[model samples]
Structures are given as C-alpha cells and as structure tokens.
Target: MIFRIVFLCLILLIIELYTFQVLKTLIKSKPALFSIQFISLLFLVYIVYSLMQFDRSVGQTQQMMFTMGLLLIVYVPKLILTLTLMGEDIYRLCVGSVNFFVDYDKSADFLNSRRKFVSQIGLGLAAVPFLSLIYGVTVGKYNYKVIKQRIFFPDLPDAFDGFTITQISDVHSGSFDNPEKINYAIDLVNEQNSDLILFTGDIVNTDAKEMHPWIETFNKIKKHEYGKYSVLGNHDYGEYVTWPTEAAKEDNFQAIKNLYGEIGFNLLLNEHTFIQKGEDKIALVGVENWGHNFKQAGDLSKASGQLKKEDFKILMSHDPSHWEHVVQHDDKHYHLTLSGHTHGMQFGIEIPGYFKWSLAQYVYKQWAGLYENLGRYVYVNRGFGFHAYPGRVGIMPEITVIELKKGVNVA
Candidate 1:
C-alpha cells in the first residue's frame, strides 16, 4: 500500500509538470505563468493536507472525499492532456523524420506548425472534462434520477404479473455530506410507492455506526404494500476497516445486521422468504456478500434451499458478478436478480435505451442496467449513493423501478 501511494504521487507529479509545460504557451506572460503555478501548488497542498487528517486504518470520511474530488477535477484533464501531448510528439517525430528526407528546406516549418496545431487542439479539448468534473462535484452528484424498467418473464406468477419493485443499492451512508439532498432522495423513493422495495446492499461504507445519523431519515421511506427487503453487499461485512480484535469485528458485524431492522428493512442473510399474495407466492432469496475478488460469504445454494424449480424467484445479490457466475445457471432458475456493487464505477455515460457504458462494465459483466442469459434476467442498479469519490459524474445516483410482466417467452 505504501508503495502504491508513492507510485501514484510520482505519476501525479509527472502529469502536473507536463500539463504546465503545455499550458505555458496558452498564457503567454511570466507573471501569469507564476500565478498559475502558485494556484496549482495550493490545490495540491490542500489535497495533501486533507488526506493527512485521516488515518489509513479508518474508513474514508467527507473531508477525504472532497480532497480526492478536487484532485480528480484538476488532474484528470491534465492526465488527458499528457496523453494527447505524447501523441502529438510521436506524430511530430514521424513527420519530421519524413520531412528530413523528402522536403529538407520546409522540414522545420512543417514540424513546428504541426506541433502548435496539435498542442492547441489538446489544450482546447482538455477544458471539456475539466469543466464536466467541476459540474459533477457541484450539481451532478445529487442529481437523483429514477430509472424504470420492465422485464417480461414467462413463468411469473399471475398474482405478481404486474408486480412493481423499487430497488436501491449501495447507500454508503458514511460518504453522505448533505442532509437536505439525501432527504430529498428518500422522499423520491417513497413517492414511487411500488409493491416492494429491494435494496441490494452496501448500506454503510464500512461499519454499522455510519448509519446511526441517517437511520431515522431513511426509515421514513414509506413502506410498500408488500415490504422492504435487503441483502448484504461486500462493504456491509465490516471488513474494510481495521478492528482491534476479532470479537470486536464480530460485534460490529452483528450491529450492522441489527441496524437493518432499525431502518425497517428485513435483512436476509443466506435465507429465503415468501411474499404471498392470496394463493400465489413468489420466492425472494438473499445471500450474504459474495464477490469474485472480495468477500465470499454468500451461500446461494443455502439461500435457495427449499424453493422449488418452478417457483418464480427474485434473488438479491449485491455484486452482479454473483449473478453472472452463480444464479444465472442455478438449477432453481431465479427469474430475476438485483445488484449494485459496481456503482457503475460512479462514472459513465448512460442513455436510457440508446446507449449505456461505464468503466465498471469492463470489470463486472453485469455492471449496470439489465442483462439476460437463457431467459434469466439481472438488473444492476447504478447505486443510490456515492463513495470514495464524494461525487458522481455522468452516472447519477439511481432509484430503479422494475415492473414484472407475465408473458410468453416469445424469444
């Protein structure tokens, strides 16, 4: 970890230096250059100072979040500028070499002209992402949006043919810095008034104590006609933060489980429950946190223990990888699986139907939105809250409303 931090710092310094080198021509005076360098240095100081306040052993807090956010806003564009500058240099070398042989007289002019043009273009394009990140921190992070989807399943129980489920995931309460905005999001969830509320996981960033301040606020979410149910995400296991003892860690884990009840959510841990509607019933299975690279505590087999193969099932597994690796091929054939662990990498371009893409997609096959395989379906929520980064970019906080439709499998 220490080596990683040092390596990252070295990389950041390199990018900052290269960016200032390119930016020099854009601001043509020595005094202006000094001013820019001074401001950049101050930003770097603020980032380092904010970071020093938090211990590495403890979970992240709002201060660290803003610090990182500042770095992202400034440095991400610089990183892009660095890459573009390198590409221009490569182009210049190629053209200059060709000119050295073909047109020796105009070689200097051609190389310099091309270099200036590319540098101008690179600096011009850098403003786009820089401004985007600034706006993301200011307004986009709390721009809560509802995404509605309808999934058709041939075997859906008639009683639940049009069952509406409002799903939210990855609350990460510890990272929340604004009460008014969070309260507004909670109210929006209640406004949906779906038949059931399913939370995939990551209620807290690290430990159960993070939820203490927001318990009452979130508990206000109007219970749906059926009920609110949740399953644990990887972060809910209290494994990220350091504990003094194993017993203390266990105590923290137990407290988190209890907190779910305090917030009016039925926390399912490797268990199956039935949502009965007069005569017909649907199976809801929830497992503990399970991920390929993270925790592996979830027991899908045990969670679906007594359910019949024909039962209409909805499994809530925090990580989409779980759905991709296990539930999709399970003999029980879970009709739908809900997840949110990827948080869509908290950044991505997502257009309802035309396009949806994120860096998270590269890591998790079922990262966000919906996926289908052999008739089974998985909907990965983009997450209801932010973490680590403090703000969201193109991928805003999400409240997913999915309506289940009973239909013939025409496909």
Candidate 2:
C-alpha cells in the first residue's frame, strides 16, 4: 500500500509540474507563478501529512474528505490539462516532422508559437471538468435523486400488482460527515411509502463500530407495510480491514448483522422469505456477498431451496456481476435482482433515457440502472452513500423505487 501511494504521488507530481509550466504563460508574472506553485505545494504537503497522521481504526472521514477535495480541485484539472496537452503535442510533432521534411530551412519560431496557443487552449478546455468536479464535491454528493421504475412481469403475483418496493444500497456510513443530511435522505425513503424496502448491502465501510452513531438515525426510517429486508455486501464481510484474530472478524460481522435487525431490517444471509398479500405470495431470496471477482459467499441453491422454478423470485445480491455470471441463465429463474457494489464509480455523464455513461461501465456491464437478459431483470442502484471517495461526481446518491406490475407487453 505504501509503495502504491508513493508511486501515485510521484505521477501526480510530474503532471502538476507540467501543468503549472503551461499555466505560466497565462500568468506571465514570475512572482504570481511562484505564489501559485507555493500554495499548491503547501496543499500537497498537507495532504501527505494528514494521511500519515490519519486514524484508521475509526474510519478517517476528515482525511478522506481532504484527499477527495484535493483530487477534485487539483489533480482532476491537471488530468484534463495533461490530456489536452498530449493531444496538441502529438499534432505538433506530426506537423513539425512534415515541415522539416518539406523545407530544411524553416525556423523553430512557428512551432514555439503554436505551443503557446496549444497551452492556452488546453487550459481553457480544462475549466469544464474543473468546474464540474467542484460542483460534484459541493453539491453532487448529497444530491439525492429518487428513480422510480415500473417493471412488468407476467409471473408477478396478482396481489403484488402495483406493489411498491424501495431499494437503497451501499450505505457506507463510515464515510458520512453530515448526519443531518443522511437523516433527510432517510426521510425521503420513508416519504416514498413503498410496500417493501430492500437494502442491497454495504451498510458500513469497513467496521461495524462505524455504524454505531447512526443506529438511531437509521431506526427512524419508517417501516414499509411488508417489512424491510437487507443482504450483506462485500464490505459487510469485514474483509477490507485487518483483525487481530479470526474470531474478532466474525464478531464484527455478527454485530453488523445484529445492527441490521435493530434498525428494523430482516438481515437475510443465504435465505428465502415470502411476502404475502391475501393468498398470493412472492419469494424474496437474499444471498451473502457474491461477485465475479469479489466474495462468493452467496449460495443461490441454499437461498432458493424452499422455492420452485415457477416462483416469482426477487434476488438481492450486492454486486451486479452476480447477475451476469450466475443468476441470468440459472435453472431457477429469478424475476428480479437488486445490487449496488459499483456505485457508478460515483462519477460519469448520465443523460436520462438519452445517454448514460460512466467509467464504471468498462468494469461492470450492469453498473447502474435496469438491465434484462433472458427475462431476468436486475437494477443496480448507484448507491445511498459515498465510500472510498468522500464525494460523488455526476452519479449522485440514489433512492430507487420499483413498482411491480403484472402483465405482458406486446411490442
């Protein structure tokens, strides 16, 4: 980890040097350039000092926030400037090579002039991402948007028609710096007044103790008519942090599971339960943490043991990769699956119904929103809270409400 950090810092430092060199043209005064560089150097030094002094045991929210701010304010803009500068350099190289070949007597002044123009253009182009990242840190992170989706299934029970299910996932409580804001998000969840509520894992970042402060706040989340159900995500297994002993890790996992119940959530681990309305019933199957490259504790066979293939099953698996690798083509057809591991990378451009994209798409095919394959559907909620990075960019925190409709559509 230390080596990785050092390597990353070295790369960022190089990029910063190059970016500031180009920026020198904009601020032609040597004193002003020196002042800006000095301030940036101070910020970088502070970041390193804070990281070294940060407390890992309690989840260092302040330190992480600072680092996130640095990334947004400094590194991200540098990245844009670097890329733009690289493109111009490539173009200049091609043009210069042609000019040298055509006329051996040409002076270097033209290339130097183009270089200045390229630097200015690069800096100008860099502002869009810089401003967008600033917005992400200040407002986008807490911008809670509720996405309501209506899913029609021929197998959906008649009694469950129009049944509303609110799903939230990846509540990385350890990263939260504002409790009041979280309380408001919970209030929004209750305001939906859905019949059932499902949480698709990642309740805490790395430790169960991190959630102690928010227990009561979460308990205040109004119960749905059918009840609230939760499943363990990869982080819930307490695998990210080191424990003194195996038993200690087990204890932490148990405490988290217990906390789920304390806050009115039916913590499901490789289990199946039925939610009934009148005489009609649908199976809600929940498995432990499961992903292609992540934890594989989820046992589909065990969770679906009591149900038949014909049952209308809703599976809650934390990582959407489970759907692509396991659930989609399984013998026991799962009508729907809910997941939230990707967090949409907490960044990306999303134009609803027109163009939706994130770097996360390259990593996970079903990173966010609804996807269907072989009549089995999965909706990957962006997330309910921030995690490693303290803030979100284009992808805001999510509150998903899925309304189940019964019927078939012919198109």
Candidate 3:
C-alpha cells in the first residue's frame, strides 16, 4: 500500500511540474500565476487526503465520489497540457542538438523560445474534456435517454412477437443526489409504457440502505402488464466492502434483494418463469450476478429448470461477460439476453446506428447495445445511474426499450 501511494505521488508530482511549466510559459502576471499554482496545490492535497481517508469497512462515500470528480477535473486537463508540452520539448531537443553541432562559431540560445500559440492550442484542447466532465457531474448524470431497440428472432413465440420490454440497469442509487431528477427519470420510464419492465441490477453501490430514500420514487413506475422482473448485478452482492462479520454481509445482501421487491419487482434468483400470452408462453430466465471477472453465483442450468433448449427464452444476467463467455455457447440456446454491467464505462461516444465506442469495449466484447451470435442476441443497457467519477460524458445514462419481432430483421 505504501509503495502504491509513493508511486501515485511521483506521478502526480511529474504532472504538477509539467502543468506548472505550461502556466509559466503562458502567463506573465506573477500574482495570477501564484494564485493558480496555490489553488492547484490545494486541490492536489485535498485529493490525496480524501483518498487516504477511504475506509474499506465503509466502502464508497459521497466525499470519495467528490474527491474522484475533483481529481479528474483537475488532472485530466493538466495531463493534456503535459503531453502537449512534452511533444514540444522533443522538437526543441532535436533543434538544440543540431544548433550546438552546426553553429560552433556563434552562440545561439540552446533552444527556441516556447511558442505562445502552442500553449494556447494545448489549453484549448484541454477545455473540451474539462467542460465535458464538469457538465457530466452537474448535468449529464441524470440525463437519461430512452433508447429504443428492435431485435428479430425466427423462433420467437408468435403471440409475443411484438412484446416490448423496458430495461434499466446499474441504478447505483447511493450515487443519486437530486431527488427531482430521480423523479423525472422515473416518470420517463413509465412513459415508455413497455409491455414488461426488467431491471438488470446494481440498485445500490454496496449497501441496501442506499436505496431506502428512493424506494418511493421508483415505486412510482406503473405496473407493467407483463410484470416487472429483475436479476442481481455484481454490486448488489455487497462484495466491495469489508463487513464486520459474515452475518452482517448476508444481512445486507438480503436487504438489497428486498429492495427490488419494495419497488414492485419480482426478484428472480437463479430461476425462470413463463410469461404467458394466451396459449403461447416464453420463458423469462433470470440468474444471480455472474461475470467473467466478478461473482459467479448465477447458475444457468438451475435457472433453466424444466425448460428445454427449444423453448423461446429471454435470459437476464447482469454482466454481458456472462453471455460472451457462457450463455452464448450453452446448448440451451438462449434466444435473447439482457445485460448492463458495463455502463459503457459511463463514458463513450454513441452516434446511434452509425458509430459507438468506449474504453469498455476493449474489456467487454458486448459492452453496450445489441450484439448477436449465430441467431442469439444480447442487449447491454448503458446504465441508468452514475458511479465512481460521479458523472457521465459522451455515454449518457440509458433506459432501454427493446421490441421483440418474430421475423428476421431485413434492415
């Protein structure tokens, strides 16, 4: 732990020095420069102090979230400045070497003067993420987008062909700060009026109590005709924190499970239920949190129960990695799966059907949106709440409404 701390300090120190160089190059006012440096130093100190205060026993806190936000806001732009200056330094070094060798008779200043325009350009580039991150914390976190998706399946039960399911995942309720905004998002979910609603979980960051205050706001969601169902996400397991005892952790886990029921959802735990439509029915299988890199409590075989491979099924597993690794290859042949653990890393560019990209894609193959393999499908929601950094960027919070069609998609 000490080594990690020292390594971090060294990195921060280097960033600070480079950032100071940029400020020195651009500004001539001594007072203004001193003020900026002083403020930056204070931020750095506060961030270090807040991070040091982190307690594994208690897990994530609002103060920690604030520290993370401040750290990113302060450093990301500075890192950009550092990189820009480093590039210029490389050019300067090359020129200085040539001048020293070729101009031996005359004394020329070792290197060219730092260009003001270069610093200006660097600052300009830095402002994009700086403003974007600020906006994310202040506004983008609650900016919920109801994304509509249509998936086609040849084996889809005819009666449920046009079924619409609204999926909201990774609520991370503990991170919520604005009651009015939460209510607005809830209203938006109801407005979708989909046939069924599925919450592919995270409901809280760690503790179930994190969701206590918002239970009423979430309950405001009108009952769906096809019923509300949910499966647990990794965070719902309360595994991130250190518990005083096994009993305490178990109690917290049980409470988290109850939170779903309080919000009018049928908590499906390694189980399957048939959503009947007249004489036709399709299995709705839900499993506990299972991820390639996380908890593996989910059991697909147990969830399938008596259902056969030929059954029309829709599986809800929290992490897309579960599908990427297991469900897709399972002989049961799940026709469609819904997942949302990635949250698109809560930062990415998505231009509808044209283009979508995030750092998360490198880690999880099915990071966001619909992905298909050999007639099977999985839709990864972009998440309905923020975590860690306290806000989102290009990847806004999402509420997914998916329509299941019987025929193959011609488009």
The best candidate in terms of lDDT = 3
Shift of residue 258 alpha carbon in model 2, Å? 1.1
Model 3: colliding residue pairs: none
Ranking by TM-score: 3, 2, 1
TM-scores, all models, native as reference = 0.94, 0.95, 0.97
lDDT by residue for model 3 over 37-149, one digit each (tens)? 99999988998888888899998999999999998898999899989999999999888888888766248777888998888989999998899889989988989999999
Worst 10 residues of 1 by lDDT: 107-116
lDDT of every predicted structure (CA atoms): 0.86, 0.87, 0.93
Residues 206-313, candidate 2: write the lDDT tens digits.
888889999999999897889899999998888876677899889999998887898899999999999999999999999999889998999999999868899999
Best model per TM-score? 3
TM-score between model 2 and native: 0.95
> Which ranges in model 3 have alpha carbons more than 4 Å from their true place?
100-110
All candidates in order of lDDT, best leading: 3, 2, 1
Q: Clash pairs of candidate 2?
A: none
